[model samples]
Target: MTTATTGDTTPTPRSRLLPQGVGVIADVAAVAALLAGGGRPIVWAGSLGAVLAGSYLLVRRLGQPVDRTAVVGLVVAVVGAGIFGYALRPSPPAGPAQQTTATPHSTDPTAGSPTPGATTNSTAPGATAGSPTPGASAADTPAETWLADVAAVDGGEGWRHGAATVAGTEHPRSVIGSTCSSTHDGHESFNLARRYSRFRSTIGMPDDAPNDAHTRFRVLVDRKVLFQQDLRLGQTATVDVGVRNGLRLTLEVDSIGTTSCGDTAVWGGAVLRR
Candidate 1:
């Protein structure tokens, strides 16, 4: 009686999981095949590895035990991807081209010019005696230099007009012994030497009249006025009217009507060094 009847029982849950395992294997193979055709080899490897690990997880979800080796492989793949992402980044661009150096010009053998970097400021070094001061004007021009250098005083410029020669005229009317007449109250008379000169001279007021009649000369060097005498008629005296530098040398001479002061009577001059 106890020997009983033959009975059938349901299989364990794990027995049913074999089909999911097969499905996971198919999914992993499909993912791997797709990744294998990717353009980049590194991307293909990473994607294939990830898909395999995902298949293993799916197998474990379907009641199969997870393999520790598969978890380690997935971790290693992730680390490798991070390293690749860091190392394979694009670098900065190549810069512009470098500049080319210029070649020196060939020298002429017959020329007397010195070679480059050979000519110095002065002939000798450590020669402080002949060194020039910082603010020195052309204050020491020799006689030969002075005679060689000449320039036009003023032409179509400033208050004075008409051409006034620097060299004294033949038998200049105003000299050491000459008798000159001061026609107006403010008339400038000048003394002449063997080498007498005038920088500027005028016989009449400017065309702009009294406003522009005064001449302004910026005295650079300390100057001496040889003599300024008021000679009306048959009157004469010797005097020294010296002027210092930086001072404005103004010669404001009055006029005797429109056509009175001849060129010879009114004279103005400056002595400058180059």
Candidate 2:
């Protein structure tokens, strides 16, 4: 008598369960990686999945047993793929950084107030004369006074004292200087008390001035002319006059022709340096 053997070596349900669960988890992770900007993570996940699947098929074809070791490897691979996908995920764009600036404290009690005897017929609303320009630092320069700060004693005809625009540039401290006619000149006088050494300014026509606008600017110390220039539209002059030991400072603007139509002069950044 002889004994016969059967070749029914199918894997048990318990043995297949772990690998199937791990495979499902890997597929889910790959889908997630694809949804979250599929770049290197998708490629890595697909490659690992293909390798593990191929190994499983090869083992099956060779009639080898699907053991606990194989299931553990599948679990490890899935876990690693998940970690890699998470690591390689795209990040959000960074926002602009916030900035903080501190304003310097002023030592002079009267720093922002208008100087005594400084007068203007009309001032722009919220105008502060004799004050340092916005963003100006007291420690940056010597003690100084702006011509726009002092009140005019003799004349301010057609002159508006405050911040104004000239040649498309904004002057934080300036005077809109103008004149009515060639004969009747517009002027502004300040009692300097012989305190300042130099007067400095940039003179130009407003950007909106007519093309034919023409005028002459004069700086006088104690009724004596120090600097004079004729300017037309788009022309600018830098005035630097020595006013040491001078009692009065005057700025005058007159028309070049008969009438001063469309003449909008700007005395920009006019200041006296000590």
Candidate 3:
């Protein structure tokens, strides 16, 4: 005659540290964008929403009222959820099945074997009976190579993001430039008059600063002023620019070479050929 059991105690609501303060500012802006060099993939996915809002505020503060920096930000949200569970782990599972190595032929063609169409388009080494196949010439036919090397094209100087590739020094293509700005003068305006006016290279400080500091290399076409110079530090100035037909070219460098982001202007070997 006894049937009345209902122990319904219930009590679990507490989780709101505002997702542990937005997952500790998205895990410190994804560890400062992974120490600066990585792009912010939405701040590394906000460090997994700050480790699921610090595991729902550490299970609503287990024994209650927590705060030693909220238990060191819930141990940096469980070490950023085990380092994003091994940095987003996943790959490895497509196609993958390639391993080949097979070679062993000798069907005894008359023992010393030597008669499969007698092999000969007169293969090299003094190719007899009339030689001269090494590229068979229009005189080897390959000479107009520098058709364009302006920082390798598309309006070159690497579209300027602090453009600087003065390699082996003494700048040639060694200069694609920018100096951030300071009244201005680091230029590169383009358009070599299409009809293909020549343009070798060299303009300022590189070939290892043969000179440094005077900065003032100019050149204009449609607007007139052909080529101007003033380089100095260690000295550099061999930009042979030639123009003829319907054109428009202007290149100036003079952010002044010292400050104003050290302009150092370049075009060192910025070619444009026939």
Candidate 4:
């Protein structure tokens, strides 16, 4: 008995994908969007969709005799990848930086002032001014006056060790840091007089400061210690000097351990407030 067999012509798993033409449209759109300087959303969506569609087309048509969709899709993916990488590359480091924010002041005619001859200013949200008393919290600034920045005050002295103002674009307060040698030991002073109320500052090391920086930062109000402690990189110690004792403010920096190897100290920014 002789058996005759017929050939089977069923499509295999690895055969050309059904939506061959869809990939072409996706690739073109993605490349066009990328080349047109499109923003993140459009570029990302286009590129991602193009990559998946293009890859599927390329793989399915790998052994096909003559199909331009696979090659074109592959090119679009590569080009899209290159464009995406370039567009998302990190920006260069910014130059020597300075950043500061304004202390929003209230605009009420009947608002109370800090002191008789002293001016006042509004603070961040939730600030209320109270009448001056024997023990007034710096937080209880009066509504009528504007609090002045430390650098803007008069008789501010004693950054003998070395002082520099760093304005942080995003920080609420400007940063006043030291530019002194490793073994720095000195006092910086600011006289608020009767013009300002809340006198305060924070002791900290600058961002990206050396690991070996060791500092004993101190804040003194009228010869009385408000805050005194050791400060390290990325550590913040706050000092609050009320307007009742707002006559004077001083900053003391001393390297405690390791001889101040990277002892760069910062104490005040918007130091005097209301």
Candidate 5:
């Protein structure tokens, strides 16, 4: 008697594709859905579920004529597999970080410290509002410091009394000079007070001194130009500048004399509110 040995064979490529077609379709559809309108998080979730179900259905069809019990078991297995795959995908990129740094500040009027971008100060009582804190660098002071310094000066037009030394101008003057100040006068509900100066050419012969006979002036705040004008002999003009909540101000006397002469200038003292 002769005996023959037999064993079950694995699925051929064509046979395997038949059972996996639904899964392939599901994966394609899911990716397409993501590419099209998956920006909303819910879309990804729903698509994943649908795709996994389709995969299971394709597999079940290959084993058709199964009993109810087998169908139930297949459904359970598909659900478990889908959940595992979803949990395993790599997470998306994170969003930009938010600013969490708290600003440092001092409370004394004269107790301010200079920081990179802005001045840090606290409005503590009786802190010598006019004096700049030790931390203030000549260059790093804020606009309010300029305003306060200007107010302390003896110019008729407040901080605007500095002289302008612009070249080529016949009557250059320092209306406010180089000063800093702050003010709260003539202000409405809004913080709209101004600190400015009025300068006239020195009323003497062109003594070869600065502003001997020049006739021009400029107004500035924090080194920012607010107004500039050329003056005629014996003529007087005025400018009105607007200030916000802060009193920081800057007034400067730019290069003076005609273009032929090299630039020469003078700056003034600090001014604050009256």
Candidate 6:
């Protein structure tokens, strides 16, 4: 007589791996939903709960046994998901009740009136006319009159008005005068007619000028020189002269060297103030 052979009853590796793979996919989906919906607690919680419940039902329908360890793990996962979802909930918006309430002042008849010794206007004490007042708006302040904006009544051929760069500084409103060997001197005169009381400008040679280039700059009131300076390629000077009661305002530039190579002078930020 021959012995009867029996089929193997042990579970295969693939059978175990299939269930584990399904569980892992479900877990990844839950975590993704939680992270993606961090600001929406309801979306995160609902998605995670639905995925876990579906996974459990699917496993049960596949004839998988529900053990004590699996049941404990499922409970732990749900509790942890709830805690994280609650923690990641968005904060409530601020309402009118949460706003800061200012304290009410006493109901006195003279409460809003100006006190004695208090200054009403924005200008400070002893502030002169045409001067910039403290805390004054742009409308209240006097507008600047740039000399470059005005047409010169008498100007040399080399005189130019517009934007220019001097000593590596930019001047949006400027007047430039050039002096060469053919013309040793350049001048530009504006008819102020005694309207302006102060004149301000920065005098310097153009940055593109030769290193040895030297020139003399002069500011004159009614043909009288009020300010003068000799400047080199990189030298600069500030001209703040009083042109009070002056009829004519003139700017002159003269080449100091015999060659006068690159003797380009610039009057940067030239303005007349009243």
Candidate lDDT (C-alpha), each:
0.32, 0.69, 0.52, 0.55, 0.39, 0.69
Q: Is candidate 1 or candidate 5 better by lDDT?
A: 5
RMSD to native, candidate 6: 18.1
Each model's total of backbone clashes? 2, 3, 19, 12, 55, 0
Better of 3 and 5 by lDDT: 3
Q: Could you tell me the lDDT of residue 121 within candidate 4?
A: 48
**lDDT digits (tens) for residues 39-63 of candidate 1:** 3455445445555554554445554
User: Lowest lDDT 10-mer window, candidate 2?
Assistant: 133-142
lDDT of 3 at 211: 41
Tens-digit lDDT string for candidate 6 (97-120): 996778765457768865554443
Tens-digit lDDT string for candidate 5 (1-274): 8888677677654444333444544554454455444454554554565555555654656667765434543554455355446545686666556545676565567865654565434332223344444444434333333222223322333223333433233432232231111321111011113321221123211223434334345554444566565543233444445433333343333323443232222332222321
Instruction: Evaluate model 6: give its TM-score.
Output: 0.47
Worst 10 residues of 1 by lDDT: 171-180
Q: How big is the positional error of residue 176 in model 6, measured in Å on the Cα after superposition? A: 0.1
For model 1, the stretches where C-alpha displacement exceeds 4 angstroms are 1-48, 51-70, 73-77, 83-88, 91-214, 219-274
Per-prediction TM-score to the true structure, in the order listed: 0.23, 0.48, 0.20, 0.38, 0.25, 0.47
Q: On residues 1-56, what C-alpha lDDT tens digit does candidate 3 reach at each position? A: 99999887798765456555655855655564673455446445656767766676
Top-down TM-score ranking: 2, 6, 4, 5, 1, 3
lDDT of 1: 0.32
Tens digit of lDDT per residue, candidate 4, span 22-129? Answer: 555655565666545647666666666666666766776778765666666676667556655655667556665644557556567787764354544454422423
Tens digits of per-residue lDDT, candidate 2, 176-247, equal: 776775433488788766566899889988778777888889999998999999998888889998898887
